[model samples]
Target: MNLAESLGDCEFQSVNTAYDENMPVDRKVLVDNATLSGVERLIGESRVRNLGNVDNDILCLEKLLTAILFSDALMAIDDYKEEYRSKRSRQFSFIKFLKLDHVSYADLSGKAADFARSMTFSFDGSKPAGDVVSFFEALRIDPQLRWDVFVSSEYLTMSLLVRDTRDVGYENSIDGVFRNESANADVVLAGIKFDAPVSMEHHAEISSIKDLVDAFASNNPNFRGSSSGSLLARCIFGYGWAAERSYFYNAVAAQNNASVFLAPLRDAFCEGCCRLESRSQVESLLAALKSKSQATMAKIVESSGQAKFALKLPFFSAYLISICDNPRQCIEHALELRNRSEFRDCRSILHNLDFLSVGERSAELNRILGLLEQSCDSLLRKYGVATANGLQVSLSLGLAGISAGTSIKLDRLFPFYRNRPFSRLFRNIAQDMVNVERLGGLYEKLCASVKEHQDAGYPSRTSVTPKFMERRENEYGRPAKL
Candidate 1:
């Protein structure tokens, strides 16, 4: 049948040929041409267009064909037949064509047919070349692509490069795609190289900080005991959950020298404290504190407390509670002591914890709090804090009490001191009482500072309101006194 007649029903109809013994036809050529024609027709129907750039089109088409063939081969694999059947069905409309340079349609179709034939025949148990085998094997084993047929265009392009090239290591492949100048520095540093085309859904999943950490931890083998681990440490230290970063650093430190992370840890701690506008940020600072030595924690606290924009008292309380031998026990002991005196000062600490509790209780906030709580619990247990029954005490109460006490002390001693340095304020609070120490030396300093500040005839910075209209008038030639 003619091409039009063969495809008249919108399905691939078998072409029948009449053969003459006297004049033998090249049946293979005819069949190939017929298949090419069918593909062209489909491409046309799908509205696949190419730009007028031949070189770019050729390159893109080669990658697209390779990806399509690889997907088909994977579906044909006996081991994954059942698993991929539904996936294949779902991917019927998944192949999207970006505008490629205009190349000869015949040349592109011929190349695609050749690729399809090569891929189809290669599944006969014959060992392929090392590069091709590794290229396919890496993709074949990717758990992320197992149940999805959707492949990212970039991944396909990378796969084609790997298949054609030799000596392309994982890092090299990653570097080639995500170059140093690329905006996705986090992905590169975290070693998140995609061997296979992952679905957009999976791409979105790994885009998150938490998932990125998990991916970094689970996927990159080169990160373990390698200098790359430190690079990853630096990268993660800039973004995501501080606790996760600390945990990763601790793990890397375990393998490498702990001293390696000390400098970075100090820097990260100070930077983290400066940006502590949320409970999660506070929790991250606490995690950093928990990971380091008592001396390191003290140094960080002291240095940060001396800054003009010192850590908030409530957050500082959380930090102190985190560093204590047993935060829960410390609070319980303090509460017991308070009870004996018939005076309850733990209210401020509780109030502080309540303030630190997630403001909106959103899912993301809940997740952050959950991770922070777990990290805090682990830190508390590390300090030998357990219940009488040998179970671990929940840190919720300890954290609350610490926060409350810190807030109360700040309110009482440094009521007018907006920038109440954590170090200064914390020192004036009795460790045993978990409340303000009226006789402490720091208390006298705070009293004098408050009195001096009051006498300076300066308005409270909080109470100062900008005169917008007056400023506008001054800017545009001040209005007459009238």
Candidate 2:
């Protein structure tokens, strides 16, 4: 009843795929082209290698099924709960739908059928054929195939991991891999809180694995502190957003703290071509974040990690600024600033500034913050910063943003550092400073609060933005306040 036995050579039936012709006009061209290309690649790769590993082939097939299920579930969520629709949100819902421990093989078979029937493929202009049709047919006719095979030791472990992860948060169930009697205290600790019921029953100390993962996930923006299933899905599918992968790997490195079962899990789940690249970038950012002095932040802002991790990676820079012994305060601070009214007016402008970091011209940047702060001197006192480090970090971040050409991001780390309205105003003033000689007048103008700029009808500058931000403008994507 093993996977290899279940997948023994079997005949496959071919079927026609029917696609919806009336897709949204704007998306039709791109979606169709991408789908066609994807199918060709999926089938071509599987068919060519006579020596293809059956287990590997099964994994690839699982990815394809997961993709179809993911897409279908997302559409359902969009229709049912429009407000709670995001790639991450949909993914969360999809895991709930899976109910991995309860889902039957028959359900998987039905899903496979639906996916196969929906996809139409063609080679050299021949009649269109669906890849899933052939794939499922092979499984359908295999005499050795049985639903019970999934419960075999290896798959049962994976199932338990997914099932427990979906029900309890990741921190609670992380050590499920070491749930067996033979697993040591470190392995048990990796999966459960030291004070958790099971951990207490065994009288284990706070596991280092737990500390490492908690810290890494807390600081890494991609994992978003607690929403971990997306990374789990990525580990299965072989590719994921760079941020998610980065944070997930950081958690993995922490598991390396417990050298027992972690290495094997890392090899199995974290195996993709991008592994080395992502690990390097993640480590670099972590090192920068961990440094006690501003030297780390300054160095990162001056290098590749600055744009990729600090600016482009969502919330990561804020996490680094907020790094402390306890992250609850930092998380709360980020959430509060995100929702504050002061930054509400120029949120998009603030976002634009994150992507526009100017590396070398720091003196000009300070001038920008100084000019903008001049107008908001009264509010600065009233804003009431919580800590000295918070204020210092915010000010440094403001300078960092100016050097990069945007300072709105400082709001996330230091709520009172740079007034958003003033940030927009200062950026306008900087943009208007065309002549070196006229810089004096521009600084004088920027010194006025943002209200003065608005009253005087100063023009705001618009910069090109990333595509992901553009997608955020869709009906379901309300700009994040937190």
Candidate 3:
């Protein structure tokens, strides 16, 4: 069904921001033909309208247009399947910022279908290739900081470009898109605010989006060692938990590295990916791994009868290196892991495990910790990453919880990300992230006070002030001098 049709019969429920003067009107955006088509038309006319008027404002508009398109594409995909949305949120912590949880699954499905259809109807098979300013025009939006939403539209469009389109202009248009983005560097950076305590611009290694994109795109073997290290740091500093990110990164590294650091680790991870029986088992595995006890591990696995997917290696290493100091336990654990996988390099990971001196093992553990520490340092210097929690909450750095202990539970986090990765009708998370970063300790103090009040038998109070005067009141609580 079309957007109008889908929205006409919408059964979704949401907190209305229209009456909240403090909230911008854009936060209450509705995905109807008028709104979507207006943006489409705006982008369409920008090329001709901005022929000779190339300026900072116009460039910012172009980036904003791209951001809008990118966010739309992401939202469309979230609508298509719940998994994609959850995976991205877990990876990027986008849900914390975007508030995808408030939306209904049914609403997502309908809107996703409309976005898919619109892509087909609007641009056709050809790229919307135009001049320098073809993608945007100089116009201040109600909420200017919602540029992250705008950029998300690009990924959906890019996926189509990569998969569906065979147009001759695709390559040229894609190049043009990047070129324009590069030209509008100020505009792009403006949209992405890094307000963490550290300075990202000062870091030489990963100072910009170009750097991140380049690392993700690199193919050189020489770069693998450094690139993997950087990626690992990004995952840790940017995200909250280490389960899925560890699995993804380890799998990627195993594909390239011939030398296996730990035997049965990769195999166990792979097996877990293929054979895991239930979410409960996954939860058990997370708890057992965190416990870092051999007996605990065996008991959990045996009781659950779960597959090897539940035995992730990085978690094992984290404990083995950090907390667990028993040689006998380490040997027993390695033997248990060995009993499952037949990888020839398993010996490399497990052989002579029982014989190593404490100093040697400690040295190895120290090395691992050093790598992690270096990575964390890099993120702080390069991306302004604060604590893993701060990054997750403030920057949407993908801090998905593996267990219920840290971050959000996988079950809840996943579904929200899957269905509503980006929202057209919710609060702007990007703005929120900035405020959280800017406020820092003050933000935490404010939250604590609010919680304290709630716990002390305070109930919600309805506003007595007029809607139009609320913004002014918030800014001016004092009596007027006049």
Best candidate (score: TM-score): 2
Over 4 Å off in model 2, which ranges? Answer: 1-77, 81-278, 293-306, 311-349, 354-482
**In candidate 2, what are the lDDT values of residues 1-482, reduced to their tens digit?**
21112223221001001111122111000011111112222233212121112112212222222222112111110111223224323322322221112233334323323322222221111111222122112111101100112122110001111222233322121222112111112221111111211011121332232442343345434333322221222111111111122222222222222101111112222221111223354345434533533231222222322222211111111232234222223223434443333332123223233333334233333332232222133223333232322321211112234222132212221222232211111010010111111223222221222112122321111111222332233322211111
Over 53-156, each residue of candidate 1 has an lDDT whose tens digit, in order, gives: 11111112222222221121111111113443344334323322122123433333333233222221111111222112322322221101100011221010
Ranking by TM-score: 2, 3, 1
The residue-level lDDT of candidate 2 at 246 comes to 22
| Alpha-carbon runs more than 4 Å astray in model 1 | 1-231, 234-239, 243-335, 338-343, 349-482
Question: Each model's number of backbone clashes?
Answer: 8, 6, 23
Question: How does each model score on lDDT?
Answer: 0.22, 0.22, 0.23
lDDT tens digits, residue span 155-228, model 3: 11111112212332222222222232222222211112221111122234543334433433352222222221
- Stretches of model 3 off by over 4 angstroms after superposition: 1-373, 383-482
Pairs in steric clash, model 1? 51-102, 53-102, 348-404, 348-405, 349-400, 349-403, 349-404, 349-405
Point out the higher-scoring one by TM-score: 2 or 3: 2
Q: Give the TM-score of candidate 1.
A: 0.16
Superposition error at 304 for model 2 (Å): 9.4
Error of 1 at 277 (Å): 8.0
